[model samples]
Target: MTTLETPVPAGHRSLRQRAGNAGRRTTSDKVFNAVLTIAMVIAMVPLFVIIGYVTYRGIGVIGWDFFTLEEPPYRRAGGGYVAGFFGTLYIMGLAILMAVPLGIATAIYVVEYGQGKLAMAIRFFSDVMTGIPSIFVGLFVYGLMVSGWISVGFGTFVAAVAIAIIMLPIVTRSAEEMLKLVPDEWRNASYGLGAGKAQTILKTVLPAAAPGLITGSMLAIARGIGETAPLILTALGSVFIVTTLQGDPQAAVPLQIYNGARQPFEEGLNRAFGGALSLFVLVLIMVVAARIIGARANKRK
Candidate 1:
């Protein structure tokens, strides 16, 4: 070897260390990884078990008649949740109609136009709203509707108001975060091109953040779908299919599942499992569809 080559010291590593040393795992690392894997498995076990159980039990109740006819008596051999199905769609649609505009406007104001005490106060209230119990929302809506503010009966419209309240804070917070994530460069470029604030927000800022906004709104809607307490108080579940927005009690999938699961008959239990599985599948479909639409929106941008 040339003089440039250093002699190896006894029991010392060459230069830094061997390739084996670089790839070697420590005991702590192994222990931590094992713990993490165990925790993940534990967390996932309940979800997988519930899905499997519901799928196994509910499959028999899923067919054309199950979705076409109103639920039968609990003592009957067979029933369906179609009434609850339409009620759910009606409530969700109304909630969306009420929430999206207000939520997006709040988000835009928070992110672009205002970041002072007012914005902080809005954010604080939204966080508090998010943490409030669903039952409280139900109570508030019940009192409000009963106080002669709204002209509708105990049905989807009132339930929709409750759900919209639930979704508003979520959408505002989520959309604000997404809007804030949009790079400042886009705004700067718009300003540099002599675009006014309104033009920039409408033409540039919102378009860039459309995908995240869509996803956040859809997530808020999904969250609203699973809440039973508000529907119980406001909609007051009915077995009859409700085609009108108001004038009668309405059935929702969450309320249907809640009522079905508590009955003493096989019919109710079957309907419960079916309702649970159907609700899960419906939410899953919404999520999947939103993701696809969001992906396409992002790509288009």
Candidate 2:
């Protein structure tokens, strides 16, 4: 016996079709997600490999003496990068002092007060400056200061200036973005409270964006600290610890690494690796500290 089936309702058929499409979409999403996950893992492999290799090669050389003693002579087996470590800190500190304030000021003008051709020009130049080669910056500083014709001479101060120039654009762009992230309502509220534009920006906007500003500054510092070419031309590298900025050549970790890597000796190679590891550790510490400070600032907010 043949049975006659009733026609399905249009709504029911549409509902079934919709469910089918939804299932297919879900499957496609899963497939894409899996592909992306695999891509991400592949990308991370090189970073992990480099870190592991550096640690393997350098960890054996690191010790209390590495942190306490001056770099050993070429024939010496046991020496340290004490001068380089502190010099790195000193130069970076000076660079940060110069760059952060100017960068923040530029960002403030761009985000808060900038609205004309001049602002656009500033942004355009900043972007261009960000991509300029480090070596070129070194060359510029070398001619402007280290050439002796200008009478500035090669020293820690000139090196700091070069690094600061490299750092300025990064800080400015990052700070501008951070300032943009602050809600307009906060500014409005400050204004509603009879605060002037300057007061509003200083009290409301800056405080609100402090965490991001710190993060950006840290990024700039990270970029500047690793620069060796500029230091080569400007600081001119020293064997002994020279902390004073008074026209005296300085020893920085990057310069130490560069010099060590060029040497044919095994000890020099080992020192290079150790310097790399030290630099990596220093940057990691700074990043972590910045994160902690940002988190605390967020909590206060």
**Best by the lDDT measure:** 2
Q: TM-score of every model?
A: 0.88, 0.89
- lDDT tens digits, residue span 264-291, model 1: 9888888889888998998898788778
RMSD of each: 3.8, 4.3
lDDT of 2: 0.89
**Regions of candidate 1 where Cα sits further than 4 Å from its true position:** 1-25, 147-153, 289-301
Q: Please, what are the lDDT tens digits per residue for candidate 2 over residues 9-44?
A: 766664334664788899999999999999999999
For candidate 2, the per-residue lDDT at 70 reads 89
Residue runs of model 2 more than 4 Å from their true location after superposition = 1-20, 291-301
